[model samples]
Target: MPFTPITAEQRFVLDHVVRVRELAATERFAAASDDVIDAVLEGVGAFAAGEWAPLLRAGDTVGARWTPEGVRMPDGYAEAYHDYVDGGWGTIGVPEAHGGQGLPFAIQTAVLDTLGTANMAFALCPTLTVGAIEALAHHGSAEQQRLYLPHLATGAWTGTMNLTEPQAGSDVGALRTTATPLGDGTWRIKGTKIFISFGDHDMAENIVHLVLARTPDAPVGTKGISLFLVPKFRLDEDGRPGAANDVRVVSIEHKMGLHASPTCVLSFGDHDDCVGELIGPEHGGMRAMFTMMNNARLNVGLQGVQAAEAATQAAVAYALERVQSARAGGTSRDAVRIVEHPDVRRMLMRMKAQTQAARALVYYAAGQVDRAGSGDARARGRLELVTPLAKAHGTDLGNEVASLGIQVHGGMGYIEETGAAQFFRDVRITSIYEGTNGIQAADLVGRKLALGREASGGGVFAELIADMRDEAQDARLIALIDACEATGQALADASTDDRLAASYPFLTMVSVATCGWLMERQGRAATDDAPFMRMKRACVRFYLEQIVPEALGLVAAAQAPADVLYAVEAELFAE
Candidate 1:
C-alpha cells in the first residue's frame, strides 16, 4: 500500500486541540499564517507520499551496505535525500536568520510526522540534523553558527549525536571518550562511540558529529564532560568540505530494523588526528547534550505517532478488503469483510483512537515548545513536565497499536510480505533510543513532577491538572484527574523506592488523562454529521467510554508500596 499522509487529521488537531493560531499571534511565529500552514501541510504531504513512500520497501530489504572505506546507502536513498533537501522540507523549523523558514516548531513536528509515516528509516537522517541545528543555534560560538548552521539548516551537510559508548548507555557518566586541547585552538577527540545514527552515509557532503568527551585534567563523572563539533570533513578556509577529519566508521550494526539508517560504531582519532572544536563552556557537555536529547525525545515520540498512523492505515485497509466469517448478527449468512465483524471493529476503533490521541498529545507538546520559544517561562515549565509523558506514552501507544494491527491482520500481519510487521520492527527502537520509555517514566516522577514549585506547594504538574479539570469535566476524565492528583501527592510524599515503584503507572494515568482531555476537546469541536465528523465523534466516544476508564484501574498499581516488589528475594528468583 502507498503511504498516505493524514493531512486533514493533522490540520484538525492543530486547529482544534493545540490551536496553532495562538502561535501565529506571536511575533516569533507570525510568518506561520494560515496560508503558509495550509500550503505546508498540503505540499509536504504530497512530497512525502510521492517522493519518500516509494523507498520504504527497498530501504528495509536492501538496507545500507558497509565497506572499509565508508557506508553506502541503499539505491535511490541518495536521490530521495537530495530531493528532500532540494524541496526545502528540512528548513521549516530552522530560523530564517540561518537560511530557513523560521516557522513554529509545531509545524516542523507535523512535517516530520508526515514524512516519517511515509518512510521512517529515511526520516531519521533529517531528524538528527534538526537536533544539531537546535543545539548549534543555542550554544555554538558565532563563528561555529556562521560556519555550520546554514548547511545544516539546508541539509547540505548532515549531523549526528555521539553519546552512547559501549560502556555508557544510560549511565552517560561512565563514558571514557577523551578530548585533548591542541595549541591551535582545536581539540583532538579520541575514543570509540557506538550507536551513532546517520554517522556516515553517501547522502550528504559531510557529517558534523556533536561529541561528548572529557578533558585530560577535568573532574570525574559527567561534571568533566564537554561537547565538541567533529565533522567528518574539515571545513576549508572558505568554509566548505576540505580535509578528511580522521573520523572513521568502524562498522555499522546489523539491526533488527531501521536498516536504511546506518547505526555506526565510530572510531575517532584512530590515526591520531581527529580535530574537534568546543561547542559550549568546558565541562558543560551534559547541559549541551540535553538540548539535543530533549529535542530528540519529542521527535522520537512523534515516531510513535508515525508508526501508529501507518499501522492504523494498513490495518484499516486490510480489514475493509479481506473477507472473513459471516457477520455476527446479520440477516445474510454469506461471508463479509472482516471490518463488518464486531470484534475487528473494536480493534480498529481502538487503533484509530489511540493514534489520534497520541498525535494530539505530541502536537500539544510541540505547541508548548512554540510558546516557550515566545519566551513564556511557564510554558517551558509545562513543556518539561509533559515531555516525559509525551515521549513515554506516545511510543507505548505506538507499540501497542502496532501489535493490535498485527492481531487485526490475523495470520497475514505476522508475515513480512504484507508489510504490517515492518511497522512494529521499525518503531520498536523509538521507545528505546531517546531515553527508554522506562527512563522517561522515572524522569516524570524523579524530576519533572516537582518543577516550578511555588510556595503554595503546587507546581507545574498541579497547575496542569487544574487546567485539565477546568477544560474537561467529563466523569471519566474527572475520575482520572482525581486519581492523578491523589497519586501525585502520594508519590511526592513517598520514599525514593516507593516513588520509583509507582512511576510507570503514574505516568500512564497522567498521560491518559491528558489525552482524554484533548480527545474531549476534539469531540466537542467535531459538531457536524459529515463522514469525517461522524467517525471523529465515534472514535472520541470510544476513547472516553472504553480507554479513559482504564486509567482508574491503574490507580491501585500507582500507589502500591515498594515492599511488594522487594519481597521477592533476589537470589531466590534464580531458582
Candidate 2:
C-alpha cells in the first residue's frame, strides 16, 4: 500500500480540535496565515509521499553501513535529504533570524507527522536537528548562535544530542565524560558516548553534537554536569569545516529496527585535542539539556501517532483487498473481502480510533507549546501536565495499534515482505527512546503532579478536568468525564511511592480519558454529509463505547495498594 499523508485528518485537528488559528493571531506567529499553513501542509505532504516514502523499504533492507571513513546511508537517502533541505521543510518552525520561515511549532509538528509516517528512519535525522535548534535558540551565547544557528536551521548542517554513555543510560549522573578547561575560552572533552542517533552520517557538510560532560572539581551527580558544543570538524577562520576534530565513531549498534538510522558509539577527544565550547552556564548542563529533551519527547510522541496512522492505513488497505471466506450472512458462495469480516472490522476500528485519538492529543499539546512560547502561564502549566501522558501513552498506543495491524494481516503480516511487520519492529523503539515510557510515567506521578509553585499549586490537571466536564455534551462523554475527575483526585491524593507503583496504569487512565474528551469534541464538530465525517463519527463511537471504558478499570488498578505490587517475592523468578 502506498503511504498517504492524511492531510485531511491533520487539517481537521488543526482547525477544530487544536484551534491552531488562535496561535496565528499572536504577534509572534501572525505571519502563519491559514493559506500559508494549508500550502505548507500540501507541499510537505506531497514531498513526503513522492520523495521520502519510496525510500522506506530500501532503507530497511540496505540499512546504513559503517566504513572506516564514516557511516554511509542507504541509496537515495542523500538525495532525499538534500531535497528536504532544498524544500525548506526542516526550518518551518525555526526563528526568522536563523534563516528559517518562522512558522508555529504546531505547523512543524504537522510536517513531522507526515515525514515520520512516510519514513521514520529518514525523519529521525531532522527530529534531532530540531531538538538541537530548540536547545541552542534558548541557551546558546550570541557568538555560538551566530556561528551555528544559520546552517543548522537551514539544514545545510545537521545536529545530534550526546548524553548517554556506557556507564550511564538513564542515570546521567553516572557518566564519566570529562571536560577540562583549556584556559582560552574552550575546553578539552574526553569520554565515550553511546546510542548516539545519526551520530556519524555523510548527509551534511558538518555535524554539531550537543554533549554533556563534567568539569574537574564539579559537584557529583547531575548537578556537576555541563553542556558543550562539539563539532565533528574544527571550524576555520571563515567559519566552515576545516580539520577533523578528535571525535571518532567507534561502532554503530545493530538494532531490532530503524536499521537505516546509525546509532553510533562516539569517542570524544581520543587524540587529546577535541575542543568544545560551553553551551550555557557551567554545571547547568542538565537544565539546558531539558530544553532539547522536552522537544524530543514531544516529537517522539508524534512519531507514535505517525506509526499508528501508517500501520492503520496498511492494515485497512490489506483487509479490503485480501479476499478470504464468504461473509457470515451472505447467500453467495463466493469469498468476500476480509474487511467484511466482523473480527477484521473490529481490529480496523480499534486501529483507526486509537490513532486518531493519539493524533488529537499530540496536536493539542503542540498548540499549548505554541501558546507557551507566547508566555501564557496556564498554557505552560497545561503543557507540563500533558507532556508525560502524551509521550508515554502516545507511544504505548503506537505499539498497541501496530500489533493490531499485524493481527489484521494474519500470517501475511508476520512475513517481512508485507511491510506490516516492519511497522511493528520500527515502532517498538518509540516506547524505549527519548526517555522510556516507564520514565515518562514516573515523571507524571512524581514531579508533574507534586503540588508546588511550579505546578501552579497543582491546579493544572484539575482545571483540565473541569474543562472536560464543561465540554461534555453527550451522556456517555459526561460519564467518562466524571470518572476521569474522580480518578484525578485519587491520583493527586496518593503517596509518592504509591503513585509510582501504579504510575503506568495511572498514565493510561489519564490518556484514555483525555482522548475521549478530544474525540467527543471532534464528534460534535464533524459534519455528516461526507463519507469522511461518517467515518469520523463511527471511530468516535467505537472509541467511546469499546475503548474509553478501559479507563474505569485502569483507575481502579492505579489506586490499588502498593504492597500488592511487591507481594511477589524475587525468589519466585528462580523457579
Best by lDDT: 1
Q: Each candidate's root-mean-square deviation in Å? A: 0.9, 1.4
Each prediction's TM-score against the native?
0.99, 0.98
Write candidate 2's Cα lDDT for 1-575 as tens digits.
46987888999999887798888888899889989988999999999999999999998889999999999999899999999999999889998998889998989999999999999888999999999999999999999899999999978889999999998999999999999999999999999999999999988999999999999999999999999999999899999998999999999999888998999999999889999999999999999999999989999999899889989999999998999999888888789999998989999999999999999999899889889988998888889888988898889999999999999999999999989988888889999998999999888777776534354554777777778887877676677667666765676788777878888887887788788889988998897779889999999999998887777767677877688757789888678
For every model in order, what is the number of clashing pairs?
0, 0
Name the TM-score of candidate 1.
0.99
Error of 1 at 446 (Å): 0.9
TM-score of candidate 2 to 2 decimals:
0.98
Residue 482, candidate 1: C-alpha displacement in angstroms: 0.8
Candidate 1 per-residue lDDT, tens place, 427-449, comes to 89988998999899899999888
Candidate 1 lDDT at 304 equals 95
